[model samples]
Target chain A: MDGIIEKAISLRFEIAAVILFGIGFINLLLQSNLIKKIVAFNVMDSSVFLFLASQGYIEGRMAPIVTNGVTDAANYVNPIPAGLVLTGIVVSVSVSAFFLALVQRLYKHYHTVDFDEIMMLAKERVE
Target chain B: MKKDMWKRFSAWVNGTSEERGPLELPDTAVHHEKKKLFELSDEQKIRLFKAGYLAVAAVVCLAVVSVLLYTVFQLPLFGDPNNPAVNDVVERYVEKGLEETGAVNMVAGMIIDYRSFDNFVESSVLFLAVTSVMMLLLRDKNNISREEDIQEEHERIIEKEASDLILQKVVSMVLPCIMLFGVYVVLNGHISPGGGFSGGAVMGAGLILYASAFGTDKVRELFNMKTFKTVTSTALLCYAASKAYSFYTGANGLHTGIPLGTPGAIFSSGLILVLDICVGMVVACTMYGFYVLFARGEI
Candidate 1:
């Protein structure tokens, strides 16, 4: 039963990751809307994070602390992944903020948020 | 499915997690169309300009002092433990009688005894910031209708498309609980992870919630410029004077006259209570000032 559950969990993870990446890829290729593409990008990113975070929480491990309230080895999951993820999260927030600000500027310049309209405006400006 | 999986699989490659985006969102329509604002008056322009200036100043300051801030913070959290100059101070005054201070509030003890001056400076900061925000909000603008009924005033702001009912409901429901929890955290600081800093923050959260949910007019009803300034200042001055009194009078220790009732008990510590109260008020007022600045987008 335990082995079956493990297999199911692994399968679920792989399936989710593949679906997320597929959505992002398909949307980028097919969708004309730039905002929709960004949403899809976020979906893919979340799936990758989900995979990393789940793998880090290994079974039967304690949180890092000194054994017997003194220095001795105690079993614990490595905290490096958590630290990496924290930095990644901050970067992601910064990227999103910059992206949105850029979006605002684009909207202001073209007076429209449609992709084809923006292209037309750029062409006009160049001409 | 088995056939698909098994047919000569290649070595798994872990690739870039933050994908290189082929799709740019420059022309992407927002999921919702934001309603257009008709005009920005002269006042709004000034507010926007002032906000921009503050943002620029903050960025420049961070660049300049980032290293100094990092080192100052690091010495306490991750310093050379065995170095004599650093180690001896920790060994004698700090380590000795730490338990006898009967203060389970380690952060409080550290603030009040080790670095009381910094704490005082921080409190003065709260007083000054609050005064500035109040002045900003209540500046020489004419005819902001002084409605006696708060609920009526909130209702009137609705025509200005003040936001949906969800925010008001959320703030009213959550603010009281946050304030209650803040007091609880501050009171139990001695034995727990949280202290006056976090507690006062929670209280500030409550005030901000109320103001955001209702409006600044309702806020004025709740607290006046004069009362808020006077109270916070007096409390802070009292905190400074306590230390000065002890120092100049040649008191043996803070523990001299005060009964150290019982170890680990809340009131057992000599000056921890006073320190906690001061911290709580400072944190609360500082947060309130910040919220006013944020809500009004000035000062």
Candidate 2:
């Protein structure tokens, strides 16, 4: 018990990221509005990125740039994670844009963003 | 005989045999009359289900969060230089990134040179996203109605007539600086913290501001659908061809012959600067295209 608390105090960023992911997941599960669902999905993506970025940091290290010709590994935080985070950011933006466009089309067809309402309307249309 | 058997099989599957004749859609009048009887019960059932779902979701979310947090505790301490993540890969990147890629920014060098195809695909994804959005939302005669056309016309007129003077003035003053900064970032991406994606986003935002302030029509003169399609496709093609050549040569141990210019110079980093410009163009076009398509449903 004491060890868990100690680790929690030290790994605060990871804990916060986990909590944020949970919040986003709950919102995604509970929200019926498509737009709100998209926002929640974004929140989840951000949390994952936050976790990745936190894993890359080293205390007292500068960013992974070759300033003043310093080429030592100890002088910079891990660059791989930064590169990975960049990829994640671009993918997330693309996903959100695609989702928003899909939601817009759905709204145009059903005149509502409500998930349940759209389902009902779609059933009616098929019948 | 075979055709007769196939016809009968399909009829049986569809419940359209002689006995049933064909499936019939329920009568709307009867459906509405019956709906009233079940509506009250259905509504209650839905409410109950919603409540139960929320409770289940809450429990599941809590369980997930707790499990993840527990795992976090087992992980190494944050910000420790001795962590497993800071491995030989980091050593190679930081120590040799400049000599190999000639880019002062190690992250930029790693992504653009080492994993060139990944970055290429990222830019392609952005282009694909904007293209998909355009397909889904671009207003056309087939999907648009008469009333919607009139409404759009009215909105366009209002946009042109009452363009906010304050926004116009502010954007005019700031637009040049924003564009210049974006260009600077893209140009100096190899030598600085900023890179293609961020720089392109800045330029895209500037274009969005200009469009919103001055109206889409004014912006269209400079950047219409034709320009957008051309720029994105050209940039993507250039990125793909260059990256493919480098990858091919490197794999075969053939000389690429591309100069890794002096580190920290504007033109350093054999292909990173050129690739950065290509990516920046694609991203900038995609961003502006998204805004224009979403706002005006054209371009």
Ten residues in sequence with the least summed lDDT for candidate 2 chain B: B20-29
User: Which stretches in model 2 have alpha-carbon errors above 4 Å?
Assistant: B1-34
Q: DockQ of all candidates, in order?
A: 0.03, 0.84
> Global CA lDDT of candidate 1, please?
0.53
Chain B alone, candidate 2, TM-score of: 0.88
Model 2: DockQ score: 0.84
Q: What is the per-candidate TM-score for chain B?
A: 0.60, 0.88
Please report, in order, the local distance difference test score of every candidate based on alpha carbons: 0.53, 0.90
Highest TM-score model number = 2
> What DockQ does candidate 1 have relative to the true complex?
0.03
lDDT of 2 by residue, B1-299 (tens): 34445766898899878774322535785466556757777789989999999999999999999999888888899898988999998899899999999999999999999888889889988988998898888998656777668988998999978889899899999999999999999999999988899999999999998988898999899999899989999999999999999989999999999999889999888999999999999989999988888877898
